[model samples]
Target: MALRVRVAPSKVVLQNLITCLILFYFVYYVSLSMCCLILQVYELDVLAPFDFKTNPSWLNTNYKVLLFSTEVTYFVCGLLFALVVEEWVWDYAISVTILHVAITSTVMLEFPLTSHWWAALGAGLISMICGGQTLAYCLFKDNFIYPDLGNF
Candidate 1:
C-alpha cells in the first residue's frame, strides 16, 4: 500500500509525486502570474478584467485573452488534482471557475477595479486549500504507512 490509496505501492507513490509537482510548481506559477493581472485590474479600476477590452468594433480582446488563459490553467490544475485523488468533482470545478470568472470579469467591467489585494489573498488561500490535500498525498508517499500501519 502507498500513502493515500493503501495499495499499489509503486504506482501510488509515483502518481503522488506527479500530483505534488503539478499542484505546487505548475499551478503555483500560473497563480503567481495572475496576481500581477489582478493588481493591474485593481489599480486601473477594472473589475471584470477578464472580458475583451477594446473599442466597440475593434475587438477589445485583451480581457478575453487573459480570462481564457487563466481559466485554462485553473481548470487543468483542478482536473489533474481530482483525477489523481480519484475525486472527480466536475461540478465543483465548473462552479469554482465560473463563479470566479464571472465575478471577477463582470465586476471589473462594470465597476471600478477597487478590489483590494486582500481579496486576491483569499483566492490564493482557496486555491491552496482546494489542492493541498492531493499535493500532500503525493509528497508524503515515500514516508508512508502500510496497511498494517507500518511505516516505511
Candidate 2:
C-alpha cells in the first residue's frame, strides 16, 4: 500500500491563509456590530467576544442575547470562510479558531477556564467547520461527486 500527499507551494498556501484570516475577522466584527445594533445591546463591550468572564449569564436577558448573537456571528464567519477559501478548508478554519483562542487568552491575561466559555468556543469552532465544509461541499459538488474521466 502507498500513501500519496499533495503539497501546495508555500506562497500560495500562505496567501490563502492570509486571505481566510482577514475575511473571517472582517466578517465576524461586522456581524457583531450588526448584532449589537439589531439586538439593541449597545452596552455590550467590544471585548465581549474575547472576555471569558462574559459568558452567557442566563439570568441576565440582555447578556444572554448578546452571547447568543456572538455565536451566530461565528457560524456566519465560517460560512464566509467556505465561500472564499478553496483548498484545505478544514485546516484554515481550525487555524483561525486556534489563533482566535490564542489572541483571546493573550488579551485577557489568562486562559478561559469556565465551561460555558469553552462550550461557546467549541460550539463556534464546530459551527465554523461544519458550516464551512457543508457549504464547500455544496459549492464544489461536481468535483466531489463526479470523477474526472479525462484523466483516466
Candidate 3:
C-alpha cells in the first residue's frame, strides 16, 4: 500500500504567497505612516519605525510609544491578512515577519541587537498571530462547524 501526499500547485501557492506579502507590507506601511503622523503631532521622530538603535534607553517615552504603535500596526496588518488569505495563517504570519526583519536589517546596515528591540519584535509577532486567528475565527466560525458523525 502506498500513501499519497497532496500539495497545492506551485503556481497557485506562489501567487498566494506573493499576494500575502504584498498585502502585508502595503497595510503595514500605510498604518505605520498614520502612526508616524500621530507621533509627529507630539514632536517625536517620524523615522522611529526605521531606527534599529541599540543604544537608546527603552525607558524613554518616545521609544515606548514607537514600540506600542509598531505592535498595534502588526496586529492590524495580521487581521487584514487573515481576512484576505482565509487560510495558512501561521505560515504567512511568520513569513512576513521574517521578511520585514530582513529588510529592516538590510536597510539599517545592522541587525537589531537590543533586548528591548527584540522584545518588541517578539510581542509584535505574537500579536500578529493572535489577531489573525481571532479575526479569522470570528469571521468564519460557521465554516469550521463539523457535521454530526455519530448519525453516520
- The TM-score leader among the candidates is 2
Instruction: Summarize candidate 3's per-residue lDDT along 1-152 as a digit string, tens digits.
Output: 99998767886667767887787666655666666676663565445566667355656656655676678877887788777766556677888778878877887888878787778878888988888878878888877556699979
Whichever of 1 and 3 has more lDDT, that candidate is 3
Top candidate, metric lDDT: 2
Global CA lDDT of candidate 2, please?
Answer: 0.74
Clashing pairs in 3: none
TM-scores of the models, in the order given: 0.31, 0.78, 0.71
Model 1 Cα lDDT, one tens digit per residue, 1-152: 66774667677656665554446345534653565475443332232334333322225344433443344455456546555544423334434444555554665555324343233334543553466445545655664444765664
CA-lDDT, candidates in order: 0.46, 0.74, 0.72
In model 2, pairs of residues that clash are: none
Order of quality (TM-score): 2, 3, 1
Query: Model 3, stretches more than 4 Å misplaced?
Result: 1-8, 41-48, 54-62, 142-152
Q: Least accurate stretch of 10 residues (summed lDDT) in model 3?
A: 39-48
By TM-score, the better pick of 2 and 3 is 2
